[model samples]
Target: MSMREINFDGIVGPSHNYAGLSPGNLAATRNAGHVSHPRAAALQGLEKMRANLRLGLAQGVFLPQPRPDHAWLDRLHQRYDTASPHLKAQALSASPMWAANAATVSPAADTADGKCHLTVANLMTMPHRSHEWPDTLRQLRLAFASGAFAVHGPVPAPFGDEGAANHMRFAAEHGRAGVEVFVYGERGGPFPARQHREASEAVARAHRLDPARTLFVQQAEVAIAAGAFHNDVVAVANERVLFAHELAFEHRDAFYADLRRLMPEVEIVEVPDARVSLADAVSSYLFNAQLATLPDGGMALILPGEARANERVWTWLQELVAGNGPIRRLEVVDVRESMANGGGPACLRLRVVADPATVDPRFLVDEAKLDRIAEIVTAHWPEAIEPGAIGDPALIAQVEQARAELLRALDLVELLDS
Candidate 1:
């Protein structure tokens, strides 16, 4: 019925520590552009996301302040700057840029939201196991202790582990429910690093997260650059179960089968695919996710007449509402820019806190356009109309639908699941 807030997601680390020399990575660079500068590539990802999220607030995460404990990224960047053709080719062949860039995209919120929430990448800078996490965690914790949500990747490794778990536990203790841990991807970040995988699994176990939370997404394995994924996820600031499309396709049957087997009372919808590249997917997610809220009734509807790639976010939203899910208020808004990076209504958002129950809807309406919109839409398209005709339905619907579709085309879902 109404639209509000747009975010400019910032990017961080393309550090060598996360993604070092790998093979097959060269091709990804070529596919995106002709630059060896990983940071530039990361920027491309950020720009794409900015373009996709049309309706939410635009803000970005500042890069980690360079520090000794986090110096591995610096080393990697140094190497990338001076990488030998042989090494570069080898690294490129293996995968795209470094894995830590997965953490680059920073989450943002509206100025009025009252709290700062940050999304962090879960991958390690170096593959080596550690008794202690880098000091970056402590610094970040101290910096934004009062944040609304600190969304990050799984705490424990996929199968299970201790070191990262300790880091995650520390984060949890400091963060409380403000922390929402999500899984990266299925194949799991460049190269076949068994130790990293083991560590990730261990962290997951230590956190007592559902395996479904341990996403084996597609983008995490390839195109994602360190923090590129975070930008899109951080844009949204509402509470709802994030339904990842990549998860649905790669593991939907099992996820659903398991859900039915364990929590049958839960209703699920298989998110439809938007056939876009991974970078695009993250953008789409960030742009459209801001307006999402819990629905009011068992069958509240949130349908976008058109969105690219058949990304059925509106459909999923409808299903969630129909199931009487915890998400109670749903507001579908316009997102044209983020779709370029493969985002939709849900991809770009990062939920910081549930909205205050008594918040007024008048805040969302554009006072300047309300009367004019109502007059025009009511005069023309009635099928796509919202109650009371506060705004131009045809114009709003057309704009919103275009934004949603663009996100589906960009592969924001792939990035989200990853």
Candidate 2:
């Protein structure tokens, strides 16, 4: 069987809310305390998955880890009322809905060895997200236990790691060995640069990636301060094509030069400053798009609805797709529920390239599975959640019960207790 890239999107959790915990995330801080509709969010996600499947793209799904993570919080011995704001924020966060921050993946094709490798991110820079790796690893192992995959623990902390949000892979074909770009920031700006150079290197070593094939680049300081918290905020790549804002990297010339030297066939699709400023891109989330290779030998940009709402971005994208470019089509997905909390279409999913036989069968999905998931969401997920409700003990119990129903419905009961 041929290996292919599969987009594994995380289902929006029942506790999905706007805590505004992520410091550098533009969307999170901008829309703090907005009401969230859990049922609508999950249904929208399922519909997006169905849309991808209808387009003949390989789509996979992951269960959201139970939230207001009581087990992990219990270790600290602080009751809900006594917990500090940061601690409370950590417990109430729905940030896991943005699974791009979950881990960095290097497919078997890119690794020196033949086994696919995954490294869970520490996310140590943010109080709410720092506690995710432990629970995330538990689920990753449960779903990727096959011999074809290697799940590595998060890089030792004191070093921040933001995962695939800062990593991009490119090659002549989806299933072939590719050049992996690890974008890091040195924290020169006001907001912390989440992907530390040390963490990126650790992941590359864990995957046993060839030094020649792996390249490290620094994220633009301006981009970080302007809320391009992760590289995905300013860049995206699919196969041999990279769509990036000109200011995405600290040293743009050197970065592109390295790519040209290493991968001559690489196609550089830069959004120049003259066309659209970095500020507009961050505000519009123009770069937070899913770059998928269509079977027709063309590419498509799966953009968030917000992208269309932004006149500047929408105008540029319209011209780009209509012009002589690799990206020939556009699809807009409404992920406003999660998008309000600083995530977009790309943020909701993690792309893994491997054969169906290599991944745990439970993670794969079809039309039937989408219908079942939608039914569960409509039946059990909360219709609405408010920012102030995070403090309610009753809401916690409600979320816990809802997640239990979800686990049983998906036959992922192993994660229920986790």
Candidate 3:
């Protein structure tokens, strides 16, 4: 079986709204209370998948998690009507649409058992996202129940794992054995540091990776303080190339030296601070772009439109493409709604290296499947959701029904019980 990287993007849920629940995520806070267009958001995500398909990339999708999580409210002993506004908002959060935080995946080549391993993240730091792992695990199990895969539950709480957002994998090729880098945070000044060091170690162990090939590095406090809540906001890695802002790690030189030692063929593409400051990098999500290996053996940076809007970012990108670099293509996509909510192209996807035939067919997509999903979104998803309308019984009903329609359309009714 040919093993290749398949990017599984999360479908934006009907509950997509701007509540500004994440403290360190600058964009989320800045866009709080703004009216959100769920229909538009989901469509944009689908369009991104379609573009990937056009590029000869394998694309899969994880459906939106059930919203207004009544199970969570029940644990709190409160109904939606009686719960405080804060609790209501948390229960209705659609943050799971960012699948990068869904799990930390170790491909078959990197694990001892020769099976792809996945560990769901316990987003324990943020109240709004802390309850996401259970549903995420359900989806993981259903999609990868083959003997070629092993899915583990989240690292116990207090470790605060944020999954792939803080993880980077470097390999000569997708199916080859590679080095895994886990970036964790210890400090962020006024904002809370989300990914904990212990959590990174725990995930590495759970995946049964060789400690020699696994590296743990601390995130630069300055980057985190500047709203780089996750390392992906400042750096991204694909195969041998490491594209990042210069200040992405606390010990940049040492990390680079270590990476080079482990993988002699590694290529480091550092964006200097003078060229694009940390603030601009975080805001533009320059490093959050998907650095994918194209079928022709070249690379492409699938960037959000914000990167093109930033003069410095766009200029640097044009120069990079014009040069003799591994990254030869720049594919710009519009995921503005997700960008406003603190997620970019990378955040919207979970990268899994496996034989496509091993995954559940329901999770994979082609042009026709996307058309069916888009039709459901247009017909049942709410056109707009006001910040104040999250808890209204009418809106809640609509959100639930919209997800149900998607499940039925995909023949994934089993998820309705999830």
Candidate 4:
């Protein structure tokens, strides 16, 4: 079977808004109370997917969860109201649109039983994200329904689990068995560490990964406090290269040493702390990029528009690509709507290494499908969304109807249920 990594990007929902729910997310906090362009956001995301498909890469799409998500409120025997700040915030969360946090994936090549593994994140750390896993699990299982995959639920909470945002895998090639790196964190400062060490180990064991091929690294508490709530905010990995901030981990040097021992051919491409401080890295989301292996054996950095706009980040990227680096080019995309909520190109996707033929055909993407999805977004999605307007019956009805239209466009009628 042919093998390649499929990037399943979340289709941005019509309820996109800036509620500033994530504590350490600088963009969300900085852009709080701002108006959002739901149609623009969805169209931009679709364009990104189309770009990847044109590159001969395996591109897929994940439908967004219904917004004004009153599921949790219904479970709690409560109704939507501004009785408390948290109550109001939960009803307006659009976090499920960032699919990276949905699950941690282990390629079939890396697992012991020759079956891929997927574990839906608990996401128990933030109020806005707490309700995402159950919905996410349903979608994942339906998409990867073949016996070739084994899907697991999150480790019961009180222990936070932020999926691939805190996970990275490295290998000699995209199709080979690789080393899985699970980054966990500790509570040290104002920001609550979202990924627990126990949760990392639990997922690794559940995936039946080889002990020798799995590793657990602790995220630096300082990074978490500096708005890097997720390890991905400071680090990202491709086939054999790691682009990370110097201070991303608790014991950075030791972690790298262990990684070298496990995978001797691995290359470390670090952004020096002196060049870009942790705060700037978090703010610019320099590390939150998609380092994709292009068809011609060269790598390209798929960056959000913000990275090129940041003086320090863009200057460094230009020099990096100009030199004899593996990253051959930069493809900047406009995911500003998602960027305003503290996620980037990397944040919008869940990567899976598998044979495309084995996955459900409905999840696969093509130019015709992309055009149809875009048509639906342009025709049905809300033009703009204000945080306060989320409580309006018209806005809720419009959002729900837009999501339904998208599902029908993609043949994902199963997700229309509560």
**Model 2 error, position 211 (Å):** 0.4
Candidate 1 global lDDT: 0.30
Give per-model TM-scores.
0.38, 0.97, 0.99, 0.97
Residues 103-136, model 3: lDDT tens digits:
9999999999999999999999998899899999
Q: Model 2 Cα displacement at 44 (Å)?
A: 1.6
What does candidate 4's lDDT look like per residue over 1-418, in tens digits? 8888899999998888887888878788889889988899889888888878877778988888977677888877777754354665676677887888989999988889999999999999887889888889998998999998999998897888999999999999978989999999986488788899999999999999999989999999889888898999999999999989998999998999999999999989888888888877887788888889988988988888888888988888888999887787888888888888888989999999988888998988899989998899999988998767867779888988988988887778988994
Tell me which of candidates 1 and 4 scores higher on lDDT. 4
State how far residue 317 of model 3 sits from its true place (Å): 0.8
- Provide the lowest-lDDT 10-residue window in model 2: 80-89
Angstrom error of the Cα, residue 412, model 4: value is 1.5
How does residue 3 of candidate 2 score in lDDT?
86
Off by over 4 Å in 3: none
What does candidate 1's lDDT look like per residue over 1-418, in tens digits? 1211222222222221222222222222323322233233233334333433322332222222221122443446644335443333322221111112222221222212334333233433323222113322432343244433343433443432222111111011111222223333334355332224444444344334446423332223332342233222322212223334442223446644543444334434323345333443333342234333222212212212233233544444555556645445444434332222223333322222223221222211232322332233233322322221212334334423332332233332222111
Ranking of candidates on TM-score, top first: 3, 2, 4, 1
Model 4, runs deviating above 4 Å = 81-86
Q: What local lDDT score does residue 39 receive in model 3, on the 0 to 100 scale?
A: 95
Model 2 vs truth, CA RMSD? 1.3
Clashing pairs in 2: none
The C-alpha lDDT values of all candidates are 0.30, 0.86, 0.95, 0.87
